[model samples]
Target: MGSCIICGTDVEGDGRICRSHQEDVVFDFRGNSPDQLVANRFYRGVVDGYADFGVFVDLAPGVTGLLHRSELDVRLESLEWEPGDDVFVQVTGVRDNGNIDLAWSIRQADREFRGELVHDGDSEWLPTDQADETEATDTAVETEPVEATSETEQTETAPTETEPTETADEPEPTETASEPETTETASEPETESAVEAAAEPADSVTASDERVTVASLGDRVDETVRLEGEVVSVRQTGGPTIFELRDETGVVDAAAFVEPGVRAYPDVVVGDAIRLDGEVERRRGDLQVETEALAVLAGDDADAVETRLAEALTAEARPEGLQPLAGDEAVAGLGEGLLDAAEAIRRAVLESRPIVVRHPATADGYVAGAALERAVLPLIDDAHEQSDAAYHYFTRRPTDEPVYGMDAATNDATRMLQDRDRHDEKLPLFVLVGIGSTTESADGLDLLSVYDVEAVVVDAAVADAETRAQVDTLVSPTLESVDADLSTGALVSSLASAVNDAVRSDLVHLPAVSYWAETPDRYVTLARDAGYDRERIAELREAVALEAYYQSYQDKRELIDDLLFDDGGDLAAHVSAQFREKLETERETASANLVTESVDGVEFAVLDTDAYTHRYDFPPTPLLLDDLHRHHANGDAAATVGIGTDELYVRSTGDLSVRSVASRTAEIAPEADVSTAGRREGKISFLAGERDAVEDAVVAAIADAF
Candidate 1:
């Protein structure tokens, strides 16, 4: 029996937590076999890898479990767990074949649990002070008797080894005779030479004016090298102060130590140009400079280093040309804007600045963001020596709304500011894909602009002058002479290729996957040539759309990659099947409930969404309306409207501004307070009390507008 770590109640079967407190205390499994796992007990584990069906977690070395997707509280793709991420899960069962099944725990962090214990095979152990005390006591007991016995033996053996009468006298006489000669011959001259050898190198290195680039450090390991560069980042670790130094060719970490956990060169900070003298040595298979002497470079020296870095970064960042994939004329017409956006992104990567991508939570937006991600990630890996550089340098954040609103802006601002203060990271460049080209995103853009953060908008939306003026770089075909119908995915796929042309083959099929209907002939050919058939393309699109709907605000990077690029195609097929089943059911329900009316010469199909459909489920209001409109319109001028308890959506076959309709409806039903409030697909909100009145007025308003 053992006492509970939290409540001090006695536990059974050598467990540290009582049955009542098991749920409150998280256990750290130390056992090597699955049989030691207790069902319904939460244990800390590391994410090993992901499978199509589940995530594999390693609770201990050789003890792994499957956390199936069905057991997850959220969608499998929505989980942000990467390989080696620490996660908490409950052991559901240990099968006869040595397979362990696990379930998700809502309490993921260490602080959320009341207490923690280490569970060994037969017993549970306290984690900290009590465990340490037990270990110390056992070590002391085993060593104390041996230490005393050895001391006693030494004392008894000393006299026997030396006969004091003869040996002690003989040794003293010889020592007196040879001491003077030995000291004269061996002590003074050698001491002075050794002292000079050490002092000379220290003085020479401190005063040396020679400088070497960061790229050349690998060749000069174990040798003193002087580096002149700007400090890009600074981190004070428990042992040494690490400064990321960047020169013309590359970046390297230089560690300066005053003492253990002490800050060295406290006055030096990020962006300060300095001359560092250190010995290049390998730590954990990476080259690091053990800083010996550091001094801030001044005047001409600092300016020269800064200038070299700037020129090198600029030259490396700018692409030579913007070649359209498949020679599409529309993409070529917007080449200048795409070129500028690409240059900014590449420059940010080279400067060690982070890139934050903000896109809508939709299939088209995801494809656009994923395309840029597929291109930029490889460039990041090639540019930085750090293994985890991709995580730090790039991030994709999906917004719940179609525009970059204040909520997303605030979250971004708070996160960036915290990173800057805590980790000394550079401010990230904001890349807005499929989301930032409208007036709705202006306030978010303005918030970012106040900090002088650069924002690049790559969208197919028609940008007004205000939206164009707010962003640093805008890539929109509508701004140019090209009037071709381009999906945001198609537009961004070209921009992604410009960012990194080496990944051109990977982006070939992305444009087709983004289009819901009317895919361009060239893109279809491009995708087919890339080995993705029409059926395969549809499966990929449906898979992404379903995943995007469930966790609309999360960037499901790994899962999306599998669906879009994996050759197995099983995951896509499975997910697409779910998409079809759910969509068909909703379509059937919506069609049966829909009511058609003729206002003047216009036709309208309206559904009472609140009463007839699953309002909170998949195929959201906007998506459902789009499908309904397409089926009813049949290439004719018709509109589908979904009227909910408080909100409504409008989808049309011809030109109509929901904004203009909302204005007219406000005049007809002044008490309803009608206003546009949702996605790019038109949505309006009104008081619940005036549902009938608002519906009648909106019908009249639509008839007048049509």
Candidate 2:
């Protein structure tokens, strides 16, 4: 037991601070697990990296927490903290799955706190002032006995011939504290000569007698073995150069150290087939090879390794059979496209290439992206042993627009180039869901194709020929039949199941939640079988819709997971209430301002969105128009149009093409500069000055089509 550093109150067992005074002192967490964290207590952490929605902070070598942007006072990009920079935060909560939630702290510096303590999972916390002294004393006591014993052995008998080679592993006494000083007195001259002898023949011809594959390296730990593979990636860290080597079996990181921060084997670059002799060791629970020597292979040796890798990757990348989640005939017809996409995704995982998922910030888009996220994350975890490998391998980014615009393409290209140049990472495989199925996304796809980046698009929109040609793979129902009213979420959710089959059970209920009403009978039965009732499904959909609106540009990965996959009934109910309240308020306002008109025997309901609705808040113009059309446009020939300052959304009970409407309106009102904004959502944009003319022309065009 110890007394609180701030108030002098008695603390509980093995604790340093009382509950009341815990906030008064800043803690330096040296523990390696999230269970050691005390909620609502401040601790010092180092910035690990950045994501779209948050920043990751490391409380210890093995413990990391996410500080979401919602918990920050300013924008995430405005923060100047770089990797390895120290910051302070509060542990908000720890999840059941060991994910830690963090909040920003105003007290960033240690001097701001009244007291400082180090929590190393010891019986009692140690004061910061005494931590260094205790560590030094323990180190001295541990080293002196070993040096004394080794000195006595040196005096009592002459060292054997084999001792020098054994001591050669310890380079020098002053290099690192882990290297003992006993080697200096035991075999100084002999050890130096042995090290020089080992360096001279690093490139000598070594046979494949004891060469081991990466998959079989687990049993070879602590034993020196030769490995032949191509260097896929090379990263320079503060202590060593980590070369990611990939053979026919798997990929493994081989670390070579040449002093601190210096590159080892600088001549060896990526894509070079090489043979290395290293001892396999587990570092932080991940297998890492400590390279004793590495040499790039040439001629037949390099060619043979490359051929082996290509054949193995081809065989492993392709899936057995493209199985549809349900017996939906329309979805089954898209097996060929779906199979190609799934193969590309699986191949990216095998090659250690990152996957970037781009989707719109709508409920349907979120469901689709989250479904794919659920499937791909586990495969990444199983492939790489690094704790943060999932974050590095897969990313889901939300776009505000339905089309893959140039702005998004530019952002992705910039980030990918920076990662490749700085960290030697491979260019990512882009998977666009519920978007990029039309000609509007061609420019963006072209920009990425300039660098040979592969893209796979999964959507239910009537895809265009140019866009289909641009992407590497496209999965859509238009190619089979247009009679099916399939939602984008339903289509991509099925695609996600094809990407990974282990999560098939978890994804059975997702297609039902993607629909607002009139869900297909097959999906309804699937949801019921998965134990999700009608009320629960509605609540999940409403919750995702509301949350998707708040941060339309951010992925909101964990929160979305809580709403969809995790048993978060209370959270879903709470957010759904806000969704209803906001939508009801917007509906009342838009309904009162609506005007009914008839055009050539066709009924039309029009609402001036600029005058009646909130422009930048909840219940956006698109969602509002959807609800209004369902209420007012009950007749087959009736249509609802919500006209904003420069845009209008059309919702009808019959077939309508927003692009055709825009084209006809452009001819009728040539001065308006009309253009289609969204194809499937029935959206058009026009010059704000000619809003009235554009509205009248669009109504007339719809009447002619009707």
Candidate 3:
């Protein structure tokens, strides 16, 4: 033994250097076992070559180590050491190829040792000659066993660590470690942020936007709401999927994302009713719901949706918390009373006869008062009705008529006279004329005398002069053998003045005897014959014939008496003698011309009855046409009177250029005195041709009357 050369220590045995410094050291005999000598020095060398060819390393200066590649731990492949790079080497064995076998387990052993030193905070021996000798001496007794255990452990553990490290090292370990961690950490935040963002309130989410439903994606929505409506259309786009839902309010679009690995149903079409739940989201400046779930519901579901909408609208329309007043008994009672009054009036108008009934002058004046009393009195007797207040006067006037007189003081006198004439004298006449002058026009002058006769002699004569004149002129010409007496001025004035009074007061005064005929003789005869006892006609005829014949004879005798008898004492006998002589001559002539039904044999005679004798005393009732013209010319209110099968028509002559009042059916007699005091006032005003004013006045009058 000698001192080692690498790291100096005392050497021993066969004149060789120590293992720490065994440069150029070898055994003496060529075929001898080298295991007898202990190799001390471990050299630091480069891996010169690697493969099954062997791991060649410099060992002991010039002596080379040829370690088998298979014997090396596979984990060392990650070291990437090339030629001339330093690595710890040791002598493992003497190979048959005459090369020293080397080991690099010292490098791994050093890493383990350093790790242990760091973890345990311990210092151990460095790889020097003195330390190696000391370590060898300490482990000398167990060296072979320790060495075998290390080899076995290395063989087993190295294979596993080597495979993964080897694959990672082919790229770069630092680059590989950084790439995956970056991706995974970045992706995790995105998922978490999405859930947090979707947790917002619905109002905030839907503000200023429209929501569309995305079918079958309900799970993705954090807050899903329901939309019930009819499906207007479903469409598939190559790039994306969308559908349209329509309700009465409006239409909205539904959209969804096509997930991978899911099959799409293409046959789904439009007009399907569905209920959908979805998230409202923003798309292209509009709020749209991304649908999560969609279901095809029955038609009743759509009906339910509509019902809900209608209920909402109805709720909006109702006034908040308002209710009707309770327990208004008085108001209810009043309403019932009004309804009863209206029913009574309707019944009266329907059931009443055509005759003009006179109103009593004392308590119930005016025909309307009488009619109303008649209608309501029975109801009152039953104890189920009550009467409203009634105002009394001789005649009733429409309220719209102008209030005449200098003042209230002057009105009493005029009204008194009017009342006296209307009730006491029964002389008030209302002449409704159509297209004529005044009621006293020449064509119907004698009308006044007839009305006066009817009024004074027969009592209570109210006539319409205009209607009489129309009969004498237009109606009379159409009838056979009728004559009209048109000359009589005093009678005309009296009748005209009476009619004017009624017109001014807006009162319709009807006559007791209404005589209207198509022929002139019929007009006069009807007037005279009315109220005459038809049973006494034969006696009355003989009286009239004798009186007429005597009067005629007296007229001729008066002419002879005026010339021959200065004193008129024998005039009556002379008249009787002259009447006999004329009768004898007329009888013989009549007998010669007589045939069995001879018309010529009949003696034509004029009557000297009370009607003919006192005809000049009474004013005639005016005709309808004449009254209309008088009112029209004098700018007074007038109406046309026409009789229908069931009712009387009193039309205003104010705006009527046609000059006739027409019934619902046939044309009526223009001369007929159908005028009644209770009739409504005409629209015509005292001032003519003021149609607009008159219309307003008429409407006012009707309202007041009702």
Candidate 4:
């Protein structure tokens, strides 16, 4: 049977004892007697009893020894210790009660064996059964115990053959018997080995098969064990209850199958420190320990929880390579930083001599002069490459100037350069100011000139339509008369309509007018000067005002009134009456002119009813003669012209379709070689009397002769 070297008690043959006494099994040492042995030295021991600290071992046949917990490494506490296992041990001390305490020297012996194996090429098996024979041979050669027990006990034990063969099958049992003697023989080497072994517990635990950490608990999952952690959170579902536990390393979830009465106890809360005894089982990819018993140890530290949360948030907020400084710390303002950069920019602007500050596109606050300089200096540097305008600000001062603050000299210089830029670039200073429609004092004009503003936009809400229209007609023409290259610019009623009308009318060719409802009176002047009528201008003005007002109050009636009419009157009647008078006068004058112009070509005489019928069918000469006879008969007025042959012929027809014809034969004859005057007269008479049948026939004969 296997036994402990120190206690000489029988141990189980499995080469193991209770985990509490494993130190005794692995580090057996011996001396004259257990009482005479020093504490924590080599001793042979048998496992007699078990406790949380260690197993009680018997040294020197009957002397019981105690192996305290501190003497053994943590690896021993995790092993499956049995009572019959063979054990080696070291003597700790003789207690007051005559008990000799023992400790396992396995780690020390293993180190010594490894060292001897490295140098002498001897294995640990030599120390088992052959240990006594090797010691006998050493004693035979040397008389003194000190000289016989040199560090290389392996060399002394190498030649013993008989005991080596006997102990080959039971090396562990033999080791328990001989381990304490070997420790005494090789004390110096063993001491050094123990020191080295103690220094590296990680390597020792790895070398031992008995250490039980989480990594080693895989085989014992059915056995319950205890774990401790703070509760991060808890979740309960229909099947089981899950608890999240966190330690310094990381977080893991532990679950418990709900037994009948387990839920009635105090519920687990977040931030609770708890200890759990459970069997670990794998569910899905995770190792879940099924808790059989749970107990609340203490409450979680609130400060620690907050600290951890803050750390997590900080880790998430950190940029890829940069971290924000913790606690209160001042960073430079953007405006201040730009001002520092603007020194170089100031030099560039000064070199450029003249720079115009145009109105910014966005409606935010105005940019400081220093900020503007910083923004524009780079552009100036680029422009300089092309040998364009050179204008910028320059500084001559020893003191640091506050950003955007200009000294008197610098201000004057700036004004000079700005004026020069205005002249040189032919660009206007765009200023945003409100000019009221009724404010005819031209105070804004003075401000405009001072600011070198090319255009002024008046607020239409405060301005009357008539005033704005008058301003439009007056100011624009006045500017033209004075040879000032000033043009009024304003917005249209609606952006879409404005764009459409601008495109169709080529408004860009005239001037720039943007329609924004924010200012109505200005737009009214703009519309009227652009040739919109007064009523239309008023309607547009109201539309702009309505939109502006709606922007504040959302009033629908105002918008409709602006869209429909200038004032609530009969718009249709007013428009109709004006056009109707003009059209009627035009029609009467046209008719009178037509009658006066047509009356110069014909002559007639009044006749009696019977005579008028008789005279009507006659050609001009005959009709003249018929008229003469009718006038003689009735005393009516008549006229006559002398006839020529070029005159062709004449006849008359009465009003009742009776005809009378008469002509001189020579006058009726076709003209032959007629004078130019005679041909002209004949053509005239032919055209004049062509409707008469006799005149038609005579004109045809005259043409044939010609």
Order the candidate numbers by lDDT, best to worst.
Answer: 2, 1, 4, 3
- How much lDDT does each candidate structure score? 0.77, 0.78, 0.30, 0.32
- Winning model by lDDT: 2
TM-scores, one per candidate: 0.74, 0.75, 0.15, 0.16
| Best candidate according to TM-score | 2
Task: Please write out the lDDT profile of model 3 over residues 1-706, one tens digit for every residue.
Answer: 4433322466554232344323222211111233322343344455676664556765333455665654454334444567775555556666566657765452322111111100001111111112234444444322121211211011100001112344632211111110112332334243232223223223433322333323322233335566666554443321123445544333445543221111112333454566655555443233345544455656676577556545543432222221101211221222322232233222222121011112112101122222222333332222110111111201222111111112321332344444343222122222111111223232322343344311110001122344334322221111232112221111121122221222211111111111111212322343234433222222222222233222221212113212121323343344445544543453343333322111223211111112222222211111222323333222433333322222222344344322122211112222222222222222111222332333233333322322
Tens-place lDDT digits, model 4, residues 454-518: 33222212233343343321111221132111112221111111112222222211111222223
Q: Where in model 1 is the C-alpha error above 4 Å?
A: 1-210, 216-224, 281-287, 479-484, 632-637
Clashing pairs in 1: none
Residue 376, candidate 3: C-alpha displacement in angstroms: 49
Q: Kindly list the per-residue Cα lDDT of model 2 for residues 198-229, writing each as its tens digit.
A: 34334542434467888888898887778999
Error of 4 at 500 (Å): 71
1 versus 3: better TM-score goes to: 1
